[model samples]
Target: MRQTWRWFGPRDLVSIDAVRQAGAEGIVTALHHVPTGTVWSPAEIEQRKREIATMKDGSPSTLTWDVVESLPVSEDIKKQSGDWRAHIAAYKQSLRNLSDAGIGVICYNFMPVLDWTRTDLAWRLPTGGTCMRFDLTDFAAFDIFILERPGADADFPEEVRAAASARLAGMDGARQERLARNVVFGLPGAAESFTLEDVRRHLAEYAPLGADGLRANMAAFLEEVAPLAQELGLRLCCHPDDPPFSLLGLPRIMSTEADYTWLINAVDLPANGITLCSGSLGARPDNDLPGMMKRLGDRVHFLHLRNVRRETAGIPCSFHEAEHLGGGTDMVALVRAALAEEARRRVAGRADASIPFRPDHGQDILDDLGRQAQPGYPSIGRLKGLAELRGIIAAETHAG
Candidate 1:
């Protein structure tokens, strides 16, 4: 695997020097300052490339901006609503510009309204470290009591609804505001995020667009972009839903293996692929991480290697970000399977044989306790994760 780190431009708290010290060979980033659904002019992309390669003292970091973690697919494109066609045109143009700039892989998600949902940004752990968590009960409280979305009550079980009521009752105004902010925080560096009103309005708009509708829309969007991607020699990979489940009555079209299988077959183009995120897919009890990697490895383009420890056996159950190798997913077996895929690709003389993967998110520990670059991207914590994954890759290679 080729090691990489996600950098949110110059504004990111983690500097380029830190990434090099953490031993990342490549940087995964985007023109986050640019608005969604706009063309990434070559000049803009060139400027970003220069920024990625330069350091604080104007020295070379020697790290290439290899993969685009996301060139965001605008919400208009997802619903095929206003400005949809224009957005697709912009998307294709961006792809062409990126290819011209020597970037081959682009990671994007078609998840509606929200990218990744988490109820707690920093939940406490027994070791005094903190990690991101998704507690169903807390989410339900936000859904039913705080947001007060129409028909939100029917979305949860009676037991869950009761639990949420109790949870909401205990929360004072300040606590409720904090929960609302966390749930609707949107992407870390996004230009804008949802307010309470924004969530309600988006939910109303999506009420008529069911899962089937969203899936069809995703297929159409891919049909428009995937062929262009193939022509440009770019691999376009869709990230799985964060929790791999439905939330706030929104349709989750890319959560399971079946969903990914559907996506892989949608456009029938090799450019269409998967970003195999172990932590997100592993949130569901029955996902079978290593098995998915083995079966879908051929189309896998990018990897988010982390783990989650589910609190219960249920589908919408709670889970917390665990240590990279400590969660339920078999990290050793998954890494071994990735190695196997690399071997097969090598045998076939594939150009993208070695996949680029990041440490994903890590627990907040050590220097992370007081200050934070991002809520989940603790520099020291991710360094620890990368070291562990590096050791696994070494052992897996030796065994192979």
Candidate 2:
């Protein structure tokens, strides 16, 4: 695997130098300032390339922008609604610009409304560190009592509804407000965030689509762009829905192995691929990380290696970020599977022989407790995760 780190931009609390110090061979980033539906100019892309190329001290940062963590799939495109055609055209142009600049991979997700949902950004762990968490009762409390999404109570089970009521009752106005913010203010280091009203409006628009409609829209999108991605020599991968379940009564199309299989077969081309994020998929107990890697290895373009411990034994249950190697997913075995995939790809003489992977979310510890960079992207925490993942890769390589 080709080790990479996600950098927000010049404004990121984690600097390019820090990423180099963490031993990342490549940088994963996007043109975040560019609005979702706008086309990216080569000049803007080159400016970012220059930013990642050298530090303020006129020194080489020893990094190259390898993968776009996302080139945002706009709401218009997702719903095939207002300006949907224009957004698709802009997306295609952006792909051309990215490929022209030598980027090989692009990661995107089709989840509606919010990209990811979490009730707590800094949930304290037993080790005295803090990690992000998604509490079922807490999320339900926000969904039903706080955000007040219509018919939200019916979506959850009776026990969850009761627990959520109890949870909401215990909280004061300030706690309720914080929970709302945490859920809405998800996307780490984005230029802007959505207000609660914004979320409500989006939900209202999506209510009529349901699951099958949403999946069809996503398939239509792939049909348009996947072929262009193949022509441009770019690998376009869809990130699995975070938490791998429904939220705010919205449909979750890409959350399981079956969803990914459907997604890869949607366009049925080399550019149509999957971004195998273990932390997101591992939130569901049934997702076999290593097994999926082995079966879907051919179409897996990017990897997010992190884990979460499910608070309960069911779908839509609570989960908290765990250590990269200590969480529910078997990190060692997953790494070995990725290595085996790389070997096969090399043998097949593929261009994307080595998969680019970033150590995903990490618990806040050490100086990270004070630095407080991005919610799940504390510097020292991710560095520790990268070191552990690197060790596993090393052991797997030597053994092979």
Candidate 3:
């Protein structure tokens, strides 16, 4: 696996120098300032690359802006509503521009309403500093008590509603508001976020388009763009739905292996692939990570490794920033599988040999409290994760 760190360009508090200090040679980033549905110009791509190349410390490490976390799908395109063709064309143009710059992988998600949901952004960790986690009780408290969206009460069970009501009753207005922001406010790089009103409006857009409609939109987008990806030698990897389930009555098309199978089959192109996210898929016990890897390993272009402790009720899961080898996932097996897949790719003479792998969702620890970086992007924690993963990969290489 080729180790890379996600650097959110010049504005990111975690600098390229810091990423180099963390011992990563590659970078996974995007032209974030570029608006959704707009084509990224070649000049813009070159400028971002030059900026990354010229880090403050002048480290000689190579920076490949290969992985784009997301190239936002406009509401027009997602709903297949008016003027979607324009957005689709713009998206294809962006793909061409990115590919022209030699970017290899593009990671995007097809979730309807939300990207990743976290009930608490500053969830305290035992070692100090905060990590992101989804608390069911917190969400329940929000749904049943705070946002008070119509039909929200029906989303939860009777017992959950009682717990939520009790929790809500104890909170004041300020705490409730914070909880709502944490749940819905878009994290950095998450497409367009929603206000409580915005969320409802977004849901209205999807009301006419259920699971099938959303899938069709995704397929249509891929059909239009995947060929351009193949032409430009770029692999388009769609991230699975974050929680791996439906939320707020929104359709989740990428939650299961069946969804992945349908997606790859729809396009039948190597450029169309999946970003295997352990944290997201691991939230659901039914998903066999290793099995999915074996079945779809050929199409797995990128990997997000993190862990979550599933709650019994299935609504909330405690996301722990575990050491790469300490999480619920079978890291060793997964690494071996990934290595085997890469080996197969090499055997088949694939040009991009090193698969871009990053330690996803690190815990906030050490001096990260005052660093003013993106949440869950603490440098030390991710450094620890990368070190652990590197060790695991080394052992796997030796054993093989």
Off by over 4 Å in 1: none
Model 3, 1-400: lDDT tens digits are: 8888888888888888888788887888877777777887999889888877876866554666768877777778889887789889988888888877887799988877677788887778666767777777778788766766777778777887888788888889898889999888664754456789888788777887899899888888888988889888889998988788777778888988999999999999999999999888887777888888888998998988776666464543445445556656787788888888889989999876578889887777788777857877888878888888898889888855
Model 1, range 220-294, lDDT digits (tens) per residue? 999889999999999999999988999989999888989989999998888999999999999999899899999
Over all chains combined, what TM-score does candidate 2 have?
Answer: 0.99
lDDT of each: 0.91, 0.92, 0.80
Error of 2 at 1 (Å): 0.7
Cα lDDT of model 1 overall? 0.91
Query: CA RMSD for every model?
Result: 1.1, 1.0, 1.9
Instruction: In model 2, state the lDDT of residue 199.
Output: 93
Local accuracy of candidate 2 as per-residue lDDT tens digits, 223-327? 999999999999999999998999999999999999999998888998999999999999999899999999999999999999899889888889999999988
lDDT of 3 at 203: 79
Error (Å) of candidate 1 at residue 215 is 0.8
Residue 74 lDDT in candidate 2: 88
